[model samples]
Target chain A: GAGVSQSPRYKVAKRGQDVALRCDPISGHVSLFWYQQALGQGPEFLTYFQNEAQLDKSGLPSDRFFAERPEGSVSTLKIQRTQQEDSAVYLCASSPGGGTGDTQYFGPGTRLTVL
Target chain B: QQPVQSPQAVILREGEDAVINCSSSKALYSVHWYRQKHGEAPVFLMILLKGGEQKGHEKISASFNEKKQQSSLYLTASQLSYSGTYFCGTETDYKLSFGAGTTVTVRA
Candidate 1:
């Protein structure tokens, strides 16, 4: 079976430009999460979804960030205005159950570089 | 808040053993472990719930101490494949806060 996957693998955006990153979680996973990893640091949580419901967005750093998991499958994280500080690896993960304690399988992240 | 991991990094030879520890100040519902190599996503290692249960995967095992709000990961007889960064995610509710990470280097 295919594991979770993210698109573009890498993205370079100019400051002030808007960028959208995509994530495809493993088949039948009901819970999906987004995280940001700065260089030499641990991943920081961003948002979470269960099916089509955006259950938690407290981890989102700012209002400029938005995420949607319509139809309970594919998910997208959109940044309205890219900033130099936004440069980091965007990781997506999914688990078999709705609980956050479930073992999460991760995707090869989309590394975003803001120039 | 993110959990605190000890000994920011470690170096070991094949067949050696190492221990990585994670502790949180607040009560924890669960603790999750992950290992990641450079330029790759974090791979799940295991999970320990609040009951202080211990679990193992291959030669890697972990124990959760509910009262102390701490967890320890034991890597026995290390392999080259074990060289990577290990992160512990402390969960209080619906989301997890991860630690700074501990890097492990194994030589054969």
Candidate 2:
């Protein structure tokens, strides 16, 4: 792909519904990141992956949120028993380098609306 | 942790200059600059990793002062295309934190 790609541009889910957001990073990008952005706020970090290894997940708001990159390219962010607070845009980003400050190319985010 | 950014919002006439700042409470390993247009994904502008190193891309430039735990982005002779929210994200100790962005509007 030319750039990072995210699936299900917009999703509406009732309370307690489970939803999954998928991301396909640019070819050969070794680093991946997930973020959540609420209305009128900057994106907040959720988790990070270097290839298939998840290095940091401390930013995930709750244990109900889980992410995985099975083959080091396609990633999924799953929210179990969604709540109103989970209504936010989820962004996925990728980078060629795993080192400090390498530019992360972002994908068009998935807007998740939880009722 | 969130880095502190100054001037929550700014409006500028095209061709003018402006500066946005970011300061962290702890030591920083690197500082990143990104621009996000309304309804679009953010695009990386530059990264400042070495202490006292400065980098520029087009009319946008950024600097990092490691000793001060701060970084600044400078927009010289701004263009209408430069109108967007600017965010400063930092990396330190396995943590990557982004500041509350500075919203910038460049008018004709």
Top candidate (lDDT)? 1
Please give, for residues B8-91, the per-residue lDDT of candidate 1 as tens digits: 999999999999999999899899999999999999999998898999999999999989999999999999999999999998
Kindly report which residue stretches of model 2 are placed more than 4 angstroms away from their true locations once superposed. Answer: none
Off by over 4 Å in 1: none
Task: Go through the candidates in order and give each one's DockQ.
Answer: 0.81, 0.64
Worst 10 residues of 1 chain A by lDDT: A95-104
Q: What lDDT tens digits, residue by residue, belong to model 2 across residues A6-110? A: 999999999999999999999999999999987767788999999999999988999999999988999999999999999999999998988776777889899
Q: Pick the candidate with the highest DockQ.
A: 1
Query: Candidate 1: which docking quality band?
Result: high
Candidate 1 accuracy as TM-score: 0.98
lDDT of 1 by residue, A1-114 (tens): 999999979999999999999999999999999999999899999999999999999989999999999999999999989999999999999988997578889999999999
